[model samples]
Target: MDLVNSFLNFVVPPASLLMLAFSWPTLSFINVCEWIYDTYFREIDMDNKVAVITGASSGIGEQIAYEYAKRGANLVLVARRDTRLRGIAENARRLGSRNVLIMAADVVKEDDCRRFITEAINFYGRVDHLVNTASLGHTFFFEEATDPSVFPILLDINFWGNIYPTYVALPYLRQTKGRIVVNASVENWLPLPRMSLYAAAKAALINFYETLRFEVKDNVGITIATHGWIGTEMARGRFMVEEGAEMQWKEEREVHVTGGPVEEFAKLIVDGACRGNAYVKYPSWYDVFFVFRVFAPNILYWTLQMLSTNHVVRRTSYIGTGRPLYLEGSPPRKFLTAGPSTQVPVQQQLKME
Candidate 1:
């Protein structure tokens, strides 16, 4: 592994630079032409199309369902919450969906995922799009993690959760020449502090789908949605904090959080997916970091470490239940100590991804 790392470290820089130097102009030109052609000559008609969207009960998933419904798509909405699914299905129908089916199944379970896909196919006869939006997030220091199993559990939900439904839906997607839309995060490449496991899972998801795209090229379209922090239950979910030797969930109390509106972000994702675009990066500002990480990783590392320190300082006390708690307030109260607080101002932020 050391040898492999050393080789990668030695070869990656020049290879990256060469690729950028060699491919940028041609790729940019091709993209321009494609955009012009698509803008003038083509549009994806979602009317009467079938779309299976996991995590559709709330947040971005919920908004995506609304967008598709307004465009006249039939939808199969999947989530663990039966009540929420039923509510969203009603909203989808009101928004102009021809048909809306709700499946209350956890995406992490293979049997549940298989059943959901089978039911979707049985109901719709064909599926034109599969949106793998199911995901999990965690925020805690890796070394201080209380349970060793937390990491694998995170992977099982975030990585494998997306994979299972895609596998079950692939045959139907192939038959329809359908598209796959995956909601992966920017943390996949960024690896922010207090989010190591979440980053690992998303990184795996991005790479897995990228490989799948190449393997199934031209047969099926795949859109990898690389989103930054968006307003969502998953984003505002409690973060784990290290207290002495143990980890505990903390109530996040920061205001003026840096993220886009979920509805707009969802619309962008759906638009990109419908166009068969390869990637959809929201806010677009995050692309700067993606490029910065590639070219100046050491600098990005130091910056993230600084942000993590601020995060630890600003965090409040623990609330054990892993549940959603939304609190509205001014900035967090400062510590009573003499030294300067590691907490940065609201403008300079520490965010969850």
Candidate 2:
């Protein structure tokens, strides 16, 4: 058995490389065909369909809600901030969503997830799409954690926060042959510094949904979106810091947030979900790095290290400097407290009840 195993191992790598080389052109042609069909021919009517989006208060999630609304989809926006959700719901109504329900609930807790899913079913009668966009970002090195207790919340929010809702919504999604849109990160595969836990959690998320896709098959479609840096609060350095730690990195904002706008990313995500795509990546150029990671990992690691070493040595993060960080005019808070400006009148608010 050992001899056979060794023989297979010796043959597999070269054989796999040969197969890949032979198949590359065919695969590329097939992908181009699929892209063409999805772009010009295929269309999934979202008019009046229900889409439930978590982390809908801000960032990519918030923009996705708006994009869905523009497609005439009814929206269920969930977050811990009811005020922000309310404001977003108003804008969604104006954007052409016939109904917009706002629910304030923490995604980390199983009970909260179940409650919101139940409420969404009751309000919409069906959930055609479950978009899991709830996540937290971490910008400190793993070893620099002053409070190790905070580590679990990172996993809980990034992994379980997306899982619990999917678990509860899967049956309903199956009934409608619906789709699940995940807002993951490129850090899942890209070795970015100061994001050890965040990257690990995102990697778990990508794997979970990929496996789930096989089990569910055609009954439910899963669109795993791995995005690069976008202009979100997280990119603005709003990360989960230890107790009394803050994030004040005004000078570094440009360095961290340089990517496509959140609005463009959201539009692409919604379009891909409607087309039943398996994966969507923003700044799609990031896909190139995956080849480097697979074929030449040491090179990838060295390149990333070289690029990040200067920033790492600066030690401006919360754990590095041991000082509260916030933009000069902004409050010293980690989360978004103020709601977005509502252009629609209060009377125009959509009430599910």
Candidate 3:
């Protein structure tokens, strides 16, 4: 009894509050890591506005930029990949954006965020939408995982990467009454096998976003795009590189409902912004489950656990069978062509035979 009480005392909110009081201002700044947290912190609408997207090279970030551009919004695209950023900027311009600026920088650094915000103000003359879409994912069994070093990198991109840009952009977002859209994963809501750390980080994002929604309800709109299954490039690469090297092409792609293509997913987000909704989910069935979680979390949790193990390869790749998986551009088929010398190309083999 004493031990349990002591443990609770150490971990309880009061203890945490005490620790925070003595700490620097850094802890509080974490709330802005992802869009969900910034919802409460900003005041803005998204239409015909300046939208800032982190990780704007590909996947959800690129999609968001395209969405805004089509709506005739100006853009500031931020990412580490200069080539991809330039491509997206050009596309944004073609898609009817008045102006597009690309910034190549890692969002985890405070200075980078400051630079991004400064550039946004200069390019668009104002700020509106701040979308936190940069994230990283890894595959390894918890028991087999052996990288204490990788955690910081993951948190930097996943947590701090989400926060820093939003922090620097908040004052601008507040002034413009712009919306903050966070691209948090559904794994944050439904924790699954082998992705414990990623899921936990997402859950923190969701919690922060939800609370922020309450705080900012009377102010600007805050939209949290808590997503599952949209077939982004990162998810596709992870699928193709399952277990590092093996490309198990025979499997059924480890998806429940088919994840939409990039353009389709982006449209849904545009619609969500139009509706002024707070929390949105993709592949709508999963959204239903997120709602069900409110009433019976245990039931919801087990149902997902059961659904995870039902896989095409019976869990052969990485993480177990029932774990959440994303599909790629489909399987690769081999062509055989044989030669007389038996040094036949697969295509040549087929032709000769």
- The C-alpha lDDT values of all candidates are 0.74, 0.77, 0.65
Q: Candidate 3, residues 195-292: lDDT per residue as tens digits?
A: 66677777777787677778767466777776666676555442232222222221123333235676776776765764566766676567667555
Give TM per candidate: 0.78, 0.84, 0.68
User: Could you tell me the lDDT of residue 78 within candidate 2?
Assistant: 92
Model 2 residue 311 distance off true place after TM-score fit, in angstroms: 4.9
lDDT of 2 by residue, 218-329 (tens): 9999999988877775665543333233211122222344546889988999999998888898888898898788766899999888888755663434432223333233
- The C-alpha RMSD of each candidate to the native structure, in angstroms, is 7.7, 8.3, 12.2
Candidate 1 matches the true fold with a TM-score of 0.78
> Which candidate number maximizes TM-score?
2
**Candidate 1 per-residue lDDT over residues 129-232, each given as its tens digit:** 99988776755456544346445666787888889888888888899999999998888887676677788888889999999999988888999998877876
Which scores better on TM-score, 2 or 3?
Answer: 2
lDDT of 2: 0.77
- The model with the greatest lDDT is 2
C-alpha RMSD (angstroms) for model 2 = 8.3
Model 2: number of clashes? Answer: 4
Badly placed stretches (over 4 Å) of model 1 are 1-30, 238-258, 310-353
